[model samples]
Target: MSRLRVGLLANPTAAQGTAHRIGRQVDHLLRLAGISVVDLSGPSAAVARARAEDIRDSLTALVVVGGDGTVSLGAEIVAGSPVRLGVVPVGSGNDFARSLGLAVNDPESSTRALLHALSRPVVSVDAIEITAAGHSGPGHRSLALGNLNLGFDALVNARANRARSGHTVRYTTAVLRELRAFTPLPFWMEIDGGDRIELDATVLTLCNTGMFGRGMRMVPDARIDDGVLELATVSGIGRRQLLRLFPRVFAGTHTSLSAVDIRPVEQLTIGLRHGRMLRAYADGEPRELLPLTARVLPGAVRLLAEPSGSMTADPKDSQ
Candidate 1:
């Protein structure tokens, strides 16, 4: 049999210093396994993506070493392509890795597991294709392998992304800070060709995978292979109730609350009423302002993950 050839893409800015070290270790391990490895590390996302695009035709798989942002970049490169994608979770909020049931918080183990999975069959999974209004120019679309979120969650992510220190705590602090000033926004959504429904919502999320915010089960019943997106909406609630609801998300028990609504959908158009400027984030990366359409691209990409057993982990316990 021919030897396996894979490309390694490492995000140098991911996890501050952890990603670079993990990439080196993973590259060493793959070499020991007799796999031909290509170092695709770059100074920025654009360069890294360009490197992947240049080498994609020759590689059997592309292993991304970083957080969700790095993985999101990889998804864009491999989406609709024949190459399979592997992930090494080494970011602050490894929600994508957690959603895949991949081991997080440990680089060596996750890298080993990724290698083992690459040796087996690749798993086909769904991805979200996002097209924002007024941004449909060539190469204007975005891809998300995990979840897309708006409203208060997007605000918190924006704040967290701007912070200069900490990981999970940064997100938590952002959430707390934003809650003090956040109010429900009027959202209008058309789901799977259904009628447009308007409601006051604190947050809205479109999920290809169930978890976000470092393993919060925002949509507990979501499945990556289901060929459908999960829409989750949280209605207006007081500050104390919102705080209480957030902790429950780690256990996926927030779904039981009356203010929370979750449903499976194939496509949706979302916008804010009164033309307010609303931002949406996919895989923790910011997207264009709202009034966008999103659809589930069934089996759009192949992922290398755990072959069997449960891959999902409790964020609370892991943290």
Candidate 2:
């Protein structure tokens, strides 16, 4: 392997224990490859990011050993910097990793893939900078590794995030339950500084990799390095229509539906037209609030992904 100084970060309790086990596996393999590995898995996500930020100048790569949430943490630490981002997907939702052609739920294969990636040069991909104010305080910024979900998907994510555990079953259950209470959320969207368009959407998401909810393809044409974002929404749908439309998402065939719309833009602004505030979610974590501004930051991150001309993380979110 080439000369490498890697920082491995993992949440011990992530994915019910897979993260801890995989972190050790990653560390062992890196050392065996004659690469120096640093344990940056601090007590919490904040600590881990702080540690990474402190030593980022010395590290060639920051490898996240968990799911999409943990990967988002690594991106927060490394985006727009010299350090390359690496992923070992052991989390419940490896949505961010699947697009890179990496193995899921298999520790040996995923770690071996990372080992292979380390021997090659990193790949450049786009990131998103989403900025919005909190509900009661000043605004904060967040990096999105996979997507920024609004409407029904964000509603589901908000529910999943509040659970004792973040899992596919939890998210899926939330999806089912939210369907009953979820109404058409009317919002105003201004894409690329165009006029604000009013629409009621059931599932509206700004996608990077187009994969979320544990490999469900919300936007099949989304490309990580495309230098743009896709605003995907399914509007004008009732409960029964939505029920059938959602299953098609897993097959990536929902786009064929007339109600489903996908628009590519460099920047977008979305907010509630009237109702209560709708929370924004990315990679199953909550951030900011509606009246959010998001844009694509092309080539903001470098990743150690399996070569396929595509595979991607986050830019510094604006306040």
The prediction achieving the highest lDDT against the true structure is: 1
lDDT of 2 by residue, 17-106 (tens): 768877897789788878889998877888888888899989888888888888887887788887888888887778888877788777
Stretches of candidate 1 exceeding 4 Å from the true structure: 134-138, 308-319
* TM-score, per-candidate, Cα-based: 0.92, 0.91
Tell me the lDDT of candidate 2.
0.81
For each candidate in turn, give its C-alpha RMSD to the true structure in angstroms. 4.9, 4.4
Candidate 1 per-residue C-alpha lDDT over 1-319 given as tens digits, one digit per residue, 9 for 90 to 100: 2367889998998888679888998999888878899999988888888988998988888999999988888888888877888898888888888776678767779778877776565677788989986465438789889988877889999999999878788999999999897889888888898999998898788888878898799987677876898888888687788888998999999898899988889998889999798789988899868899888998787776754332222222210
Worst window of 10 by summed lDDT in candidate 2: 310-319
Q: What lDDT does each candidate get?
A: 0.83, 0.81
